[model samples]
Target: MDDYPVHQISEVVRHVGTSDRNFYDRYYFNCAPRFDGQGQSGVDGPFALIIGLGQYPNLGVADAFAVLRRGDDHLVVRASKALGEDRMDTSVGPFRLEVIEGLRRLRVVLEASPDNPDLSFDLTFTADSPAHLEARHFDRSLERVTFDTQRFVQSGTWSGSVTVEQVRTPVEDHQWSGNRDRSWGVRPVGEPEPPGRRADPAETERSCFFWIYAVLRFSEFVIITILQEDADGARIVEDAVRLWRDPERAPETLALPEHTLRFAPGGREVTHAELVFQRRDPSGGLADPLRVECTPAVACYIGVGTGYGLEQDWRHGMWQGPLTVQQLRRAVPEIAPWERMLCPVDNLVRCTLSEDGGIEEGEGLFECAVIGTYPRYGFHGLGDVAE
Candidate 1:
């Protein structure tokens, strides 16, 4: 990599700036068949797929996972490999990513795994709007840095094919839209560390009280908002913005964003939500607010077997030897008992933006997680249900 004159420092590309074992770079994407029904869940259409790839330079490991969910069938395929000096090669086993044209076009491929021949996809992503660089995410637990990362989000359309249960379906850009993000930095990955003065879950400092991240794509513009609040509803990490496809137009930063979420009966799964983004007055005072209503169209539990939160045996950056690939398929109802324990409840949310007696409709991804205690939502502790 040094021969290409792209070195950021004196060392080669393999030598990362940090020696922290948790330092990692990752790419994540999610896609679903475009919504065409009358607010239906799209269960009759193609399955929704989520793909993730991560490389831990210090840990010398690279891994990738692809998960597909449609109605009752849930399928996941994960692969891990020993990292080599060439970090440029972003392939692990049968999964690989191709940067067709950098930020403009990208492709993700997952060949059929012999162990689990039920799910595979080859999809190309074309950017619909310029990528939005999000605010830097930095958090700490006690004195140790837990998350220090930078990420960029983009909304796009996907074109290719997906095969599940040996049935291949074409993915047309006209009927499929997706969003992706690229982030890299120090974060928790792999196995848990030894119990050395571990923080208590009851402590507010150690728990994530409330969190919501959304990337909504409309025909003319895109909206991206992120919120992380403490148990008392104080803002910890927050960002709100509206982006456009025109390069001449700058990203609009929203102000004083608020959320009103309605959870399922006694559960934390968000059934409906209304996001209010206030405008800034000419003198920088508070102004009127713009409300966006969201409803879940299709839901995907991310932690099922994708090595995300606490759902399975494998995790990102974990060493699984030279090369390993595995797949899991389960009936959706069988996993319900433990599904609620997962961190995020990913949903394809249809959004309606209402302002000045007018409405514009669109759809995108809504990633949400609420645990510990969030008084704003009436959650009192870990595993507490919404009332």
Candidate 2:
């Protein structure tokens, strides 16, 4: 469907993880474009999807291109999650065995196969002639059974999978270690307090906030963040991190100042370095103000003389997808109300990312767009009238 409105993806959410550790949630906010690089031509396509998660550090998706012959009316998708682990991950392939004559469904199956077959498929509507407007229904039953077998299999990491599609020419970034910042940077100053203790302070609340540190990695590619408050509040931050050689780099072999930040899951980064403060106020009041107090007040890359930097590419953005609102409403009636909520997840929201791991049709900031799909959603990112 051309410029079909955004489908309000509603899902029963489930969270699993330790209390202190980073947590994640599953929401329908993930969305991709409807029609992709299928040439510049398009009629109304189908409601498609490429889902994703927020702050999910480890999950990734892989797919393959296959054309089923006219003989076998069915296909199976099965695969392993971590290759050598007991945890077999699978997805609910997005199609089912249909009896209709001449129907095509391209599935971006999920990874909950064998055990829980739950994923989505993009079905293009076709008929003997152009006059057939009859709609298709979303099949919960087909969603029930997984091929329990046929999965688009590939090797290597997330970036590798992109190469399989032969659609990406990655740009990487690198940096040196010899010029490491001996000081790892500091936090903002705390609130002022009295040197002496006074009398009648009433009921007070103690608040404790985490100085959250995020390390995002896809296989061998990683991005680290150690956030602190804007001490001077001038919209600038300076960062200095001490660097040291673990194996003691040979001045002859290893490049001077070249620091390696493994992007793989267990790759290491300095985590949980922080300072805590306790305030004893006579007046019963709130807890101490919690703000990142960075010594320099900003985050920056102080490239030493080596002039080296980390690998390049933000490694963010989505792939293309197709989905018509009218088609979706016909497919799954549960989303009837969502038809009214057809808008970006955020008001100033500029883009939408799908979970199936593709860049669905949507837009945001002027530069805000899926790398190539250039999804042609209505101008506002959704609706009947193009934005």
Candidate 3:
């Protein structure tokens, strides 16, 4: 398969295993071109990622990044040994280590090798350089490694509040029989409640309605890779950039258009962007999970920012989603005593930045204000936000 085009990777589900790490056996990278940096290298492929559950591939690939660079050609190394467990003869007095430049850097706190505890290497590279990273770079003499990204890769860093909001669509539920009468043919009925069609009595409900919300917020910057050309313009990348705060350093910014950046002969700012937050719901549960059809898909606006070029307001719930308490009780008439509270996201309370670093009033009232909030879970009644 060495003759296969690099693009063919996506066409086939290649299998890789982990000897040292514990998670993914195969990883996938969705490659795209962007003038977003130092023009296209035409040689270095974009930093595609582990296609699985996003744990190990990030680690192994990041680990492999330390050894390869833009100019190295046909470098065959062992991935299982560099990432996998102790298959190599470590008893031979500490394994050899090599440092390469124009590569990537990872912070190490304590050394691991039994023979060489103080092993340290300063892997320095440009802000974002094109480097070929694969686990096999560290140990070369072996073929077909037991490659698993989880076995060797460690999670990255995390900081800030920038986030991504996916649009939710309203799907149809087969549960909707549409008849106002009970499917059981109960003769006398007052208001029109949708017919219940549950095969088992336990599955039936009078009506099931819940709130779905999304918000936009700022987040920390983790990985920022950029390249400067001698006379050409600059290009900016979104996903390859890292977050310094989170353990995984996963790029909070999703994929965006490739941009051509200019350095003014030679210049770009050394940046550190801080994150702020807003909210609708952060728990990340689907608005509706039972339906089977092409539902609505729009960007969530609950936590968005103007600077980031995301001001999407999904079609549903744009105008007056959940209303006052009177409407809720009137809708079902099942629980009259339950009161609703609407506590606004008060900036005064949520934004008092003291040296102690805590919100004084953001933890405002749940019961005192009688605000316009209608909580659905755990707190069916009022006094849930704890004032």
**Best by lDDT, which number?**
1
Quote the RMSD, in angstroms, for model 3: 27.8
Q: Over the stretch 1-387, how does candidate 3's per-residue lDDT look in tens digits?
A: 334564333433222232233222221111111122352223343111111101122123211111111121111111121232322211111212222221233211112233222221221111122221211211111232322121112122111111101222121121100000001101111112243443333332221222111111112321221211111112211112223334454333212212211111111110111222221224853221111011111111111110011213211111112210000001112212222222111010011211123222101000012121223222223233322
Going through the candidates in order, what is the number of backbone clashes in each? 0, 82, 69
Scored against the true structure, residue 290 in model 2 reaches a CA lDDT of: 19
True lDDT of residue 108, candidate 3:
15
Candidate 1 regions off by >4 Å?
38-46, 199-206, 281-285
- What's the true lDDT of residue 140 in model 1? 74
**lDDT tens digits by residue: candidate 1, 1-387:** 678988887788899888999999999999888777654333484357899999999999999998888877778899999999988899999999999998889999999868668888899999999988888888776689988998999999889998887888888888888899999999889877864556544454335547789998887899999888877788877889999888889888998789999988767889999999998877988767788999987778788788875743588888789999999887876876336644687888889998767899988888888877776777766667766
lDDT (Cα, tens digit) per residue for candidate 2, span 157-239: 11111111223222111100000000101111111224232222221111111112222112222112222122121112112
lDDT of 3 at 364: 8
Evaluated against the true structure, the overall lDDT of model 2 is 0.18
Each candidate's lDDT (Cα)? Answer: 0.84, 0.18, 0.19
lDDT for model 3? 0.19
lDDT of 3 at 36: 21
